[model samples]
Target: MKAKNGLNYESNPKHTPGGQGFRPNAGIEPVNSFELFGESVSVNLKDKIHKSRYTMDNKGNIHRFSPDNRGNYHWSGSTADKIKLNIPN
Candidate 1:
């Protein structure tokens, strides 16, 4: 999921009768919002860099999420609560 974000570049292929050429593909359109635990949270990408970001809650605890080069997402927060779930690709 993180790899699919706008931070990376993709290839745009153009084919003709004889050959094909490639160019840098544009990034996906920015997503301005997303749902979090059934609640819609606004997304802000203006200050976001690369493939990681941090979110802070009202209690002063910080939540963080980012993806590693190996295609696994790493998550850590100030709280110890854990939940079992899978994010389908």
Candidate 2:
């Protein structure tokens, strides 16, 4: 599937001892901008402030984040704040 931001996704599957299978996947590329205040705001992954806790750009703009209580990170700075990731079928 394609994300709203237009990024394409790929699927990865894992097979179990039985015929059952599962898939745990991730985005192939990092997402850049987010819809904030009705506009797109960029997040600089290179300038991370606290080891993935926040993303800051050259202009010093920051995108605050938090753990999902899982192993993944979640963005919380905008209305559609979640990372625009493509989910592969």
Candidate 3:
């Protein structure tokens, strides 16, 4: 059984144009909330540039998610504890 307040469970499928052997779903949510935040920044370090981002979930936690044309969702992280946004692709 999957947790209700933590890393939930999901099942996605990978397929080609035609019907063929399918693969396990790679897009699985590791968290809960679908609401996510995104911010980008550039930092200077020893004459070098570094890019970083700040992503947050609706409930407050690092988030990572991808949306399909259909706007479907997936995940692969925890929501309550070990919070990490792992949205499906």
Question: Which 10 consecutive positions of candidate 2 have the poorest summed lDDT?
Answer: 10-19
Instruction: Compose the digit string of candidate 3's lDDT tens values, residues 1-89.
Output: 13232322233333221224344432233323333312312245567653222245555655433234453433333334343334322
Q: Write down the TM-score for model 3.
A: 0.24
Q: Compose the digit string of candidate 2's lDDT tens values, residues 1-89.
A: 33343432222222112222432232121145333111322344546433233345445555443334444333434223233322111
What are the lDDT scores of the predictions, listed in order?
Answer: 0.31, 0.33, 0.34
lDDT of 2 at 17: 20
RMSD per candidate (Å) reads 15.3, 13.5, 11.6
Superposed model 2: Cα runs more than 4 Å off: 1-52, 78-89
**Candidate with maximal TM-score:** 2
Global Cα lDDT for candidate 1: 0.31
Better of 1 and 3 by TM-score: 1
Question: Where is the poorest 10-residue window by lDDT in model 3?
Answer: 33-42
- Per-model TM-score, in order, reads 0.27, 0.29, 0.24
Model 3: lDDT equals 0.34
Q: 5-56, model 1: which lDDT tens digit per residue?
A: 3232221122112225422231211122111111212245666444544444
